[model samples]
Target: AGGQYRLFHRADLIDLLHWAARRAGVRVLLLQKVREVVPGPEPLVRLASGAELCADLVVGADGLHSVLRQALNGDEEPFFTGQVAWRAVIDNPTERRDDVTLHMAPHRHLVTYPLRQGRQLNIVAVQERAAWVGEDWRQQDDPEALRAAFADFAPDVRALLDRIETVHLWGLFRHRIAPVWHREGVALLGDALHPTLPFLAQGANMALEDGWVLAEALGRAEAIEPGLAEYRARREARVARVVRAASGNARKYHLAFPPLRWAARTGLRMAGRVAPGMMLRSFDWLYGVDVTEGSAARSRK
Candidate 1:
């Protein structure tokens, strides 16, 4: 893509947000585990410490396994996508790459990008497998397993993998958009509403857009119900499109047949040489969007 793409450490991003929230007088209560959410005229949240607090609106920004989602809608199952991903971050003091690099192979692909002022590299390797693994992202796997999985990759990639001391393995599972996004005064945001595959790298982007649109709708609406209704109505379709695109990219990257993979790679190389900007322009709908102005205006209308 021709547009500017920046990478940063997840911890650094979270720290920046934490400081910004505190500066804005947003009181963030840490370690307050929510046990139950009771939706009604007065939405009640029960904490693990036996404390019950009532709020006007509750936004669920939790990850893939969300408790509030189960309260708003019943429990639903997530289907495994027959793929697993190994993630690791290694020191890259001498490496400086501003752009993401993807090395693709049969039934597998490895993406690497630098972060933290080019002092660290983040690697995400995905492989198609028949066996199932739990979906927890924090589950650790031996570094040797990750290296063995990509033993046939390029020498440069193998050199990078050799530096990995620890890795996390997680199964890629597909979770559909919740049938109901909001009930009473409780609403879902981010992965709680839609958990996307990592192919398009739109999971965080979608969540940020959702927060923006939801805040805009609620701020302008006369009542809570109308605000939440407008939020879901405006977001649901666009998110569904992005999710479908991500899923398509997953299939395109993981073609196992030799001839098919060769053809696809050749076509991509030809496209890059002939019309480099064409590939970037195709993502205008995604990257070119200005949610604050465009989406907010659409919601008002």
Candidate 2:
């Protein structure tokens, strides 16, 4: 899809959000590790420091391994997708193109895009391998190994890889959406409810949508249960569709058979040349709708 989009550093976005939250008088806590969540009429949050607090409603926006998610629904195993990804940021001195560039190969792909006003480039490389690596994103890997994995890539891509002094490698895993999103004044959002692959670049987008929809649903409802129910109902189908689309893209990008690869490449070229806008329009269902406005319209109706 050919559409104008801007990318920002995660830290910058976080800082902006922190400012907005502070202005709204929201309490921001740091390093308060939650050890347990006791759900009931009034949910209790037990901290690792042995501090306990109760709230009328609790929303868990925690990431993949959410303690609150496990408390609401028993732990379910996450299946490794037989793929691992290395992520790194390198200084961009040449003022690279603002657009994202994807270099695809059999069983692997690399995505590079400029970040921080083109001063840096964010690189995410995924390779399908049998070796089991833990799902921790902070685990460092040898930069030489990443270069070796994509040794056959184009010179431009290789140059970017060469600039990587440090990289973090993490195994990709598919986690089913939580069976129970809301119960007993407790609800889930973001990765705590659905952890999707990065192939579609919609993981963070989906989480943002979840947060907006969750707030809208809760704000309008007279009681917590109904609001939580509405939130799940509005989100589940759309998120599931997005997750499936991302998984399908993973297969499309890693075509190994020569004939299939040729056909796929040719099809993409034809589409880009003949009907580029049509191709972009196809994603209107995914990206066009303003969720906030749509929800308000639905409420009005």
Top-scoring candidate (TM-score): 2
lDDT of 1 by residue, 265-288 (tens): 998888788998777777898888
The lDDT values for all models are 0.90, 0.89
Candidate 1's clash total is 0
lDDT of 2 by residue, 63-92 (tens): 999988998889799999999999999998
Candidate 1 deviant stretches above 4 angstroms:
294-301
Superposing all C-alpha atoms, what RMSD in Å does each candidate have to the true structure?
2.4, 2.0
* Model 2: lowest-lDDT 10 consecutive positions: 1-10
